[model samples]
Target: MDYKLIDNTEGKQYEYHIDGVIAKIEYIRAKDKIYLTHTEVPKELEGQGVASALVKDVLNDIEKKELTLIPMCPFVASYIKRHPDWKKLVLKGINIA
Candidate 1:
């Protein structure tokens, strides 16, 4: 399940286009952390791991950039819950919702 993830900086989001639909995770950076504001996967891309791939790629890039994550999106939060290893990327003392 390899995807060509694109960092559309001009759009301020990470995008992965599949099946003619775009899956994206929108974020806002504040200081050393990125607040994951939303994740959207087209209905056509559902159940194919597109959203999962998008989030994973974005999180990996954030880690590489030495920034932490503040996941406000439920999808990202649930992803972190299922993958506890990524919990390390979450900023401490911050309430994630």
Candidate 2:
């Protein structure tokens, strides 16, 4: 299993390769703050925790950069909601509505 985070200009994404298959992809962005916008893992990669791994990897980069985040993606929002430890990293005064 190989996991890597790549920034595709508009945002960052986590890419995972397993058994020579590209298994997962996640979209992320950093504007006034970082925003994780979308995520998808191939059906074969479901239940393998690939999405979680990608999210965690992106979050780690956010922390390392000392950047705040606004999780706009539903999955990312739910992930942040569940992980209170990352709340402090959320951007201040963000308007998601």
Candidate 3:
């Protein structure tokens, strides 16, 4: 499946629209860092890799924008653990478990 990810800055989230439903990652931005605090995929859309794709794009955007990541969301943290290369974008003093 082709997933399209967009940063909805006004909403403080990154959203993915699929089948008219939205899967989003909520965040709080401070200076050059962004704290990813929550991730939600509609129950009907769960287990379809939507969350993983959203995180991948979000991490890539963080990298491209040269922003530090503080993954406070368990889902995002778990994604980072599986994709070690994204660890470099994490904020200093923060650990993903």
Candidate 4:
């Protein structure tokens, strides 16, 4: 599925809209690390890969910015575990598993 990811800095979240529902990955920025705190996908959007797309785009954005991450959300951690390349984006000394 095609996806558009937006970093709503004012809202401190990355959001994507699909089928009229908004999927978001919320985070808190501290020092040089972004703590990925939660992920929410509307029920209508579930099983459609919205959450996967949201997390993938968010990880790409963080990589582009050369920022580290603490993926506190279980979904995000699982994504990183399944896609090891993105694991490099995790902040040093931080463990999410």
Candidate 5:
């Protein structure tokens, strides 16, 4: 399933608009790294892989922009734990676990 990921810079979040609801990952960027603070998926969209897809796309976007990630959100950390390949995007000194 392909979803368009929106980088709402003014809102400081990456969003996915689907079925009239938005699933988002709030972030804070400082210098070369981004702190993924929280993830939210509407109740209507839960258990539908919306959160996983959103996090995957957000990580991809971060990689493309050559920014390191710090998975401050538990959901994002767990996602990285499941997908070890994405761990490369995480900042060197940070541990997602």
Candidate 6:
């Protein structure tokens, strides 16, 4: 499966396309911190690890830019909770509540 991540500025989100279909969507912003919100992967794309790949790519971009992350998206928040290794990238004092 050929998947690619593209930022749709007009939509204020990053789209993950698998082949030609939008397999997943993630809202993002870069400022004092990188905030990720409302991530969703199509039902067909679920359990295929596409979401994980998308999140990793976004986090990699954040790391490359030396930006902290605010994972407002539940999926991202949960991902961070499960992956202690990624905690270092999170924005300090940002409540995940």
Clash totals for all candidate models: 0, 0, 0, 0, 0, 0
The better-scoring model by lDDT among 2 and 4 is 4
- Deviating ranges (above 4 Å) for candidate 6: 28-30, 95-97
Q: Where is model 3 more than 4 Å wrong at Cα?
A: none
lDDT of 2 by residue, 47-84 (tens): 97888777777788779878788777777667777776
Task: Show pairs that collide, candidate 1.
Answer: none
For model 6, how does the per-residue alpha-carbon lDDT over 49-78 read when each residue is reduced to its tens digit? 888888877777678878788888888888
In the predicted model 3, the residue pairs found to clash are none
lDDT of each: 0.87, 0.68, 0.93, 0.89, 0.95, 0.76
Q: Identify the leading candidate in terms of lDDT.
A: 5
Q: Assess every candidate by TM-score.
A: 0.90, 0.73, 0.96, 0.93, 0.96, 0.80
Question: Any idea what lDDT model 3 has?
Answer: 0.93
If the candidates were sorted by their lDDT against the true structure, best first, what order would they fall in?
5, 3, 4, 1, 6, 2
In candidate 1, where is summed lDDT lowest over 10 consecutive residues? Answer: 88-97
- For candidate 6, the lDDT comes to 0.76
Task: Supply the global lDDT for candidate 4.
Answer: 0.89
Candidate 2 residue 63 C-alpha distance from true site, Å? 0.6
If the candidates were sorted by their TM-score against the true structure, best first, what order would they fall in? 5, 3, 4, 1, 6, 2
Q: List the residue pairs that clash in candidate 5.
A: none
How high is the lDDT of residue 30 in model 2? 43
Model 3 CA RMSD to the hidden true structure, in angstroms: 0.8
How far is 71's C-alpha from truth in model 1 (Å)? 0.3
